[model samples]
Target: MASKKKKAPPPSPQSLGLPTGGVETHAHLDMEPLDAEVGAVLDRAVAAGVSRVGQVFLGPAAYKDGKAKFADRDDVFFILGIHPHDAESANGVNLDAIAQAFHADPLIKALGEIGLDFFRDWSPFEAQRIAFREQLSLARELDVPVVIHSRDAAEETLRTLDDMGFADRPVLWHCFGGDANLANEIVARGWLVSIPGTVTFPKNEAMRRAVAAMPLGAMVLETDCPFLTPIPYRGKTNEPAYLAFTAAEVAHIRDIEPAEVWHATARNAAGFFGLTLPSHT
Candidate 1:
């Protein structure tokens, strides 16, 4: 009988050896197998050099129930908004709750992952549009930064942002999986883009090119976990710890030191959300 070959060790974010102070700008830890191990997950994040995480609550209801999970965590901030999938039932009541929550919680940094998502179409397009506009209006009125989620609806999303007078305002394009052209447009609008783990995928040459061409100051890194895990750990459940892989990959694409991407993206994220994160000497 032929001898079986030894199994390769699973990849880890530690291999990237990124310095501390990385930020995970997007994550859904309220859901999963992830929630079950969230404590251990966060410890690993710090160990892997990620010091901050933005916990995105899909809507008011989710925020109400999930915000407490990170109550004791100063390193974790909050982002609450109605996602396109939940737009059908979007109403003033929900918006009121979000507004109240934002006002009551000093940690609620931005109003997002809002915007269009024609790809999912889980809710009616008209409903999604209405909810998006409503939330944008609220963000504007409250004078908070906005984090947008546009998918297969970039054109309309841009048009809507322009219509809403978002140009030159503080806004972040979350989970940016676009080509160079789109990246340029976003930069032109004075919006920063959060590059996700998708940039590390072998087939996502467009995202890699986009990261290369983007102004490093306008780019941040995110895991967008429980999903979009980077290569070498692509199929595993993503967490804040995986953010280092994303930073390393961005540095590889840009031909710079991983620490450069790590520090710059962390700074970008902190400034965008007005966060005062811990510093590593």
Candidate 2:
């Protein structure tokens, strides 16, 4: 019988040279098997230098679930909104629920993971548009920043934001996979773009180029965890601890030191999310 192939060991945060107290700007700890191990997962993240996590609540249910799970954790902030894939289910009742939760929880920092997704079209296009518009209005009313999720609908997304007149508000393009031109446009518009684990993939040259062209000031780092796990750990479930790999890749692409990428992204995340960094960071 042939011997089984040995799995490569996972990278350590310290070995990767990540800076202390780096923030994970996007993750879904409220979802799946990871949710059951939230405490341990968070402890591991801290051990890996990811001291702050922006736990994204995709819908009203996720908002409630995340609130129950992390209400007392000061290091875990919340971003609550309706994902484009679930636009069909969004309505007055749930929208109200999200708004109420936002108002009730001071930890809720932004209104999103919200925008257009033409690729999946999991929800009707019209419904996604309507939901996106309404949520942009809500973000304006609440005076909070917005996190946008535009996949294969970047043009439409930008047009809608311009039309809705909320383009002036702070916007964060989460898991940005667009080209360098789009990245430049986002930076020109004064919006932030989050670099995800996809940047570590070999075939993601476009994303790499985008990261190269984007100014450090307009960038943030995220795992989009339990999803876009970086290379060397691609087959494994992603967690905040693996964020250093993404940061390392970003540093390599930008031709800068890993610590510079980590610290700059952390600062950008803090400013965008209104998070107060620990004194040491």
Candidate 3:
């Protein structure tokens, strides 16, 4: 009989050599079904050196729940907006609700995860465009940064932002999947791009190349948790604790130490959200 294959040990903060107080800039903690375990998840994230997390809201329900759940935690921040896939549901009333939440919460740092998602087409293109524009307008009026989610609609998204005269607004392209040229354009526009756990996949050479070409100042790291689980645990449910793996891979791609990627991305995330970094000590 063949011998059983040996299982690899799970990753730990020490094993990854993660820098202290790195930020997991984008996660959907409210979307996870295990509500009771959310605290444990965040605790694991902290133990893994991810001291801060940006919880993103895709709709009104998530916004309400997230606001109540993390309202008092200084370690957690928020980005609230209707996702492009839910654009059809983003009527004036709902948009107002989102704006109200933004205005009501000082911890709500940006308005987003909003942009084009032609790949899913869960919502009509026209509705997506209208919602995108309206939220962009809201961001401008509120004088807050925007977090963008462009999937298979990069050109259209860029064109829309440019036409709306928001080309210079503070923008974070979350889970960026664009090529080097697009990355260059994003950085040139003074927008930041977040690298997700997908970078750890061996076949994702395009993403790797994009990360390699990204300037350190323009880069931030995220898990986009409950999705995009990094390698060595690809099919497992993702949490912020897995961010160190993504950071390690990014460091490898950039030919630098993981600590450099962690600190630079942490600083970039802080500047983008206008939040002060907590001392790791």
Which candidate number maximizes lDDT?
1
Q: Candidate 1 residues 1-281, lDDT tens each?
A: 99999999766888778888888999999989789887888989999998889999999889888887887777899998998888875798899988999999988999998999999868899999999999999999999999999999999999999999999999999999999999999999999999988888889988889899999999988889999988878888888898888888888888999999888888999899988767652
Q: C-alpha displacement of 121 in model 3, angstroms?
A: 2.1
Candidate 3 achieves a global lDDT of: 0.86
- lDDT (tens digit, per residue) of candidate 2 on 1-281: 99999987766765775656799999999778789999888888888788799999999887775678885677899899999999986798988888888888788899999999999968999999999999888888888999999999999988888887765569999999989999987888889999999899999898888888878999999999889999878988899989999988998988899888888888889989989997766
Worst 10 residues of 3 by lDDT: 31-40
Model 1, TM vs. native: 0.98
Q: Determine the C-alpha RMSD for candidate 3 after optimal superposition of all C-alphas.
A: 1.6
lDDT per prediction? 0.90, 0.87, 0.86
Candidate that beats the other on lDDT, 1 or 3, i.e. the better one = 1
Best of the candidates, TM-score: 1
> Which of candidates 1 and 2 reaches a greater TM-score?
1
Worst 10 residues of 2 by lDDT: 10-19
Model 1 regions lying over 4 Å from their true place: none
Root-mean-square deviation of Cα positions for candidate 1 versus the true structure, in angstroms: 1.1
